[model samples]
Target: MNYLKKILVYALPYKRYAILNIIFNILYALFGALSFVVLMPMLNILFGENHDVITEKPVLNGLNNIGGYLKDSLTYSIQTFAENDQLKALTFIIILVIVVFLLKNIFNYMALYFGTFLRNGILKDLRDTLYTKTVNLPISFFSEKRKGDIMSRIASDVNEVQNSFLSVLEIIVREPLSVIFSIAIMLTISVKLTLFVFVFIPTAGYIISVIAKRLRQQSADVQKEQGIFLSILEETLNGLKIIKGFNAQSLFNSKFTDSTKRFFNFSNKMMNRQNIATPLSEFLGIVTIAFLLWFGGRMVLIDKSLLASSFIAFMGLAYNILTPIKALSKANNNVKRGNAAAERVLEIIETTNPLEDIPNAISKTNFKTSIDINSISFKYEDDLVLKNFSLKVLKGKSVALVGQSGSGKSTIANLVTRFYDVNDGSITLDGDNIKSLTKHSLRNLMGLVTQDSILFNDSIKNNILLGKENATDKEIIDALKIANAWEFVKDLPREIETNIGDSGNKLSGGQKQRLSIARAVLKNPPIMILDEATSALDTESERLVQEALENMMKNRTSIIIAHRLSTIQNADLIVVMQKGEIAEQGTHAELILKNGVYKKLVDMQSFE
Candidate 1:
């Protein structure tokens, strides 16, 4: 219930709709109960059990005897009509039943109509917030979490919460009111029979509760299995090439099949348990009804304390209670199932982001003198990736970092960009601590291009426009031409409007890299961080992409993490790293004269 309450808090904005739904449900319940009550006078008319026709109207006295007075008044009205004409009286009673049922259904529809807004509104808000948080969270957050698990929470789990929790608005308000209204009429009809019903209801509820006891745990297992299988599917899609290349498709297939098998088993058990509620509650209701028939029949036939017409109406009221009771039982199961999903979703919405901007963080608008990394140390988990790392990138100068794999060259780029803050010491942009600046404002001053071309499934122009939301087409074309991408882009089917398939797979590797550079060129930031920007390219593609990077880096304070040392020969300063520490620092010509790490790397690559 606490989980359910947390979900319902989203409904606060739509309180007026909720209130309207409640009002309609109340009307629906009132008319639904009255529909059965109207049947008594008709029964008397049919059985010829009515005693006499009365001309005087019955008067209301006090609240306590209002039921008796209303019954007498209805009988008096029916008797008067019958005296005038029997056909007219029978027609009136039949029309009254139709009108009562018609109003009941109308109110029921109204309740459901209003509830639709509340359910869908909450669903939209939940999904939107999840996406907003997912994008705003630091990149490091994804390193420890599965993408598919997060996707499941946003897509599948939120849907489950909607179906199980939000959809219950109708059942919670309408069904219970129906039961209450129905039971109240039954008590008025006969206290003994109503008491008899009370005895069995709690017993039936206890049995149903026991059946649902393991439902929540099983539901959680089902949701967890769903996430696992989805993760497997996501991994399969991402690594299909590797799977085929290694002929390890069978291994991935078996893993996926095994996960689905568990899901199938858990879902079967959970759904079967949920399915039992409707029938079990219905059967129990019938048993109670069968008992009532015997007991109430004796009161009417033998004891003569109950009227035949009133007894039949009481039986109708008793039967009416069964539907809502069954619904209430189903609703209980739904709440249990929904609570499991709600817990999973709330875990994400409630996660405390460590990288969120601090209060009163200053906004940095431009790069000034230099970026200073002073004795910074950092780690991913417990293993230090960068230790006592120190460097300075003076404004408008290009600095290149060259190192072997796992030597913390890329870690420096990550720290300077604030992707992951240093575990020790500080990185200051100009004279101000980078941590003191808001991330949006801090990132606004820099542009990034990674080894993998991270393009979306969008038009080529739209993809580049992401760097500057309001960039003109002419600006886009100029950026593209500068990155050496305009030649290929102009030849595409739609020119700049051509769709780049997922991750720009439609374009060649060199073309993709050029478009990435174009995006950076469009942003035209003062600081450009190119991390292995041409490492994955062949000779010809590398030549093209290298030219693009050079064009983009002109007059920018550039921090380049290069795998091919040849690409950094023209950099103003070259730093060689080994084992998370700087091994050598100088210009390319000076580093070669030092006969140290930089010269060794250049010689090694030249030999390769």
Candidate 2:
């Protein structure tokens, strides 16, 4: 019930539809009971043994006013029909039964009509809210979680909320109303028999409740198992090349099969529990009805206190109550399962994003003066990556950072981009603290070209345009020509429209690197950061791409994290780092003359 309260808030926007459905259900329930009441009069006329006292004036109880009105109207209509033929009276009763049945169905249709809008409305809101929350969550939230697990919450879990639980709203309004109205009719006919129904219903309800408790735990387990297999599938697709290279297909297949096998076992348990509720409740309800028939028959024959026709109508109404009760029991279990799914979805929705921008944060649109790294000490955990590191780059100057693999080159780039916040000290741009600037504005002023050629499965033209959304076709062509990518792009069957396939797989190692260069070239930002942009390429590709980088660096402020000493030979200042601190800093030629860490690295590369 607590879970239901939280989920019901998603339906608040469609209150009008919910109310209309309830109104229609109430009418359907009333008409359904009245239809069985009509049969009592017919049975009395056909089967009552004592016919001598039939001339007594009719006495209506609960429905006296309605009965009077209907009696007067039917009497007039019967008189008119009798003038034409004696058989018209039988025809009128048959027509009355048809009209009552029609009304019952009409309201039933109305209930379903409004229910469609209510159910669909909840589904749309739930999915939209889940997606909105996912985009707002912190990067750390995803770094520690699988993409497939998040996707499952959005796709399958939200779907379960709609399919399994939304129907509970219909049962809450429609079925229970139906059961109550039918029980009232049964009580009016024979209070003693109605008491027997009450005794049997609670016992069946208790059994169903016990089964439902296990459903929530089992349902949660099934959804979790589904996420595990989805994660394996996503991982396999992303790493297919590595798996094939290592011949690890059989290992992955077994892992995926194991996850799915667990899903099957848990699903079987949940279904078995859900399927048992319906039949068990029905069988118990039938037994109660059978007992009522025997008891009611004895009262009519032996005590002479009950009428035969009312007893027959009473039995029908009692049995009708059982259908709704049994349906409610089934809906209860569905609600439990759905509650488990809703809980998982809400967990993501309620997560707080740790990287959100502050209220009234200012935006930085231009750069002037210099970018200053001031006493910036940082660490991933206890092992410091940058220890009291500081540097300054004036506008339009180029500085290159050259170091071994563990010397914090990439970590410095990551901090400058604000992919993470510093644990200590401050990084300021043009005399303003970077943290005060909007994240979008800070990134907008700079462009990045990484070691890995991160191109999407898209056309060469589309991939380049990502650098600048509204860049003209002439500008894109010019950028490609600068990066020396135009030669290959023009040779493709469709030119710029030609598909690059996954991660630009159709291109050679050098071609992919040039495309990445073209993407950064088109951005044309005031600041540029190159993280070994041409390190992973053949000699020919390196020579061609190197010329493009030097051309891009002309009159632009840049921070280059380079591994190949040849790439940074012309850097205005070369900072050699060791153990997260600057070990040497000077011009490339000055560093080699010093014969420090920089000279050793240059000599090592010279030998290779």
Candidate 3:
């Protein structure tokens, strides 16, 4: 129930539509009950049952008698208006029923019409909030989550929240009001029969509730299975090539089939439970009606105390309440199902972000002096990845890190970029602890070129413009030239405007890597970090990208993480790392002259 209220808070902005829907639902319920009650006077007239028809409206004494007085008053007015002509009275009664039925349907349509805005508005806002939260969450959060699971929350889970919100709202206001209004009319007809009807209600409610007891758990299982299959689909799409190369199609097929099988079983259980509501309510309804017929028959026929016409109208009113009661039963089941979805949706929205910036954090805008890694130690999980690692880079100089895999070369880049916080010690920018700086301000001063050559499926110019949204054509051209990507780019049909296709697959590996460098150059930040920017290329491509890197690094504070020994031979300082600790630190020639770790690495690369 708390989860239900949490989701409802998103309805604040659209409360106007919500209020309007409620008002219309109220009117609809009133007219829906009145639609049947209006025929009572007509039935009385046709049956010649009104023995004392008055010529004027009767006066109401108080609220308690208002229902009885109104019924009597309507009977008198119809009798007077028709001038005691039976045919004329029947004709007028038929017209009144038609008007009442039409108004009931109109209000029903209006309720749904306004409800559309409230339902869909909540949907749009919830999805927007979820997406913004997902994007702003720290990268570490995604390392533990499946991409498809997040997608399911945004797409499927939110949809369920919207549906549940409206279903509960409709049950809370519309259906219950319908039953209440119809029951009011029944009470006016016969306090005896209405009381008998009330006796069965709680019993019916208890039974329906018992049947729906496990619905929430079952619904959650179904929703979770949906997330699992969606994850499988996403993984299959991303690793299709690997699956095909490894001949593991049967493995994925079995996995998908198994997930779907669970989804199938869970769905069957939930739906089979929900399906019991209608018939069960109807059976309960008929049982209550049977009691009414037996009891009321004593008054109408055997005892001759109640009018036959009024008893018939009372029976119709009793049946009217059944529709809403049955509908309420079904809606209750849906809300229980939706409860599971709401819980899943709110779980993500309510999650605590571990990387939130500190209060009064400095928004430093420029790079000055040096970045001092003061004995920083960090870990991704249990074991440490960086152990008391300390290094310094002066402004306008390039320092390259060379190491084998798992040697913490990339961890340095990640820490400096503020992608993860250090578990111990501190990294300070210009002598102020980086934790004091806002992450946005910290990242703004550095441009990163990663090994993957990340590119979007968009125009070359648009992809470069991501570095600086307001950059001009000349600035972009200059950046491209600096990164050595302009020559090949200028030959394309659309040149800078040419679409790169997915991950720039239309271009060669060298071309993609150069575009990544061009994007960084266009940003033109004071610091540049290149993580193996040339390791994945052929010698020709490596030479071209290495030259581009030199141009981009000439006037910036640069930290280069590389595997290819030749790429860092000219770095101002070379730090060779081994197993989370720096094994050597000096210029390339200096390390070689020492005839140690750097010397062996260079020897190995030379042999290869």
Q: Output the number of the lDDT-best candidate.
A: 3
Error of 3 at 512 (Å): 1.8
Better of 2 and 3 by lDDT: 3
Q: For each candidate in turn, give its C-alpha RMSD to the true structure in angstroms.
A: 1.6, 3.6, 1.8
- TM-score: which candidate is best? 1
* Ranking according to lDDT, highest score first: 3, 1, 2
Please, what are the lDDT tens digits per residue for candidate 3 over residues 1-608? Answer: 56878888899999999999999999999998898788887778777886775867789999788777978888777878888787888898899999999999999999898889998999999999999899878889989887888888889888987888768877989998988998888877778778988898889889988998999999989989888899999999878889999999999999999999999999999999999878888999999889889999998999887788888888888888878888888877878877888899888898888777899999999988999998989999999999999999999888999889999999999999988899999999999898899988898899999999999999999999989999999999999999999999999999999998988989999999999999999999999999999989999999999999999998899999999988887889999999889999999879989999989988989833
Give the Cα RMSD of candidate 2.
3.6
Model 1 C-alpha lDDT versus the unseen true structure: 0.88
Off by over 4 Å in 1: 61-63, 79-84
lDDT of 2 by residue, 158-212 (tens): 8888776445764777778888888877766667777877887788778778877
What TM-score would each prediction reach against the true structure?
0.97, 0.89, 0.96
Locate the minimum summed-lDDT window of 10 residues in model 2: 48-57
Span of ten consecutive residues with least summed lDDT in model 3: 48-57
Any runs in candidate 2 off by more than 4 Å, and if so which?
A: 1-4, 45-90
Order the candidates by TM-score, highest first: 1, 3, 2
Error of 1 at 149 (Å): 1.5
Q: Give the winner by TM-score: 1 or 2.
A: 1
* Over 4 Å off, model 3: 62-64
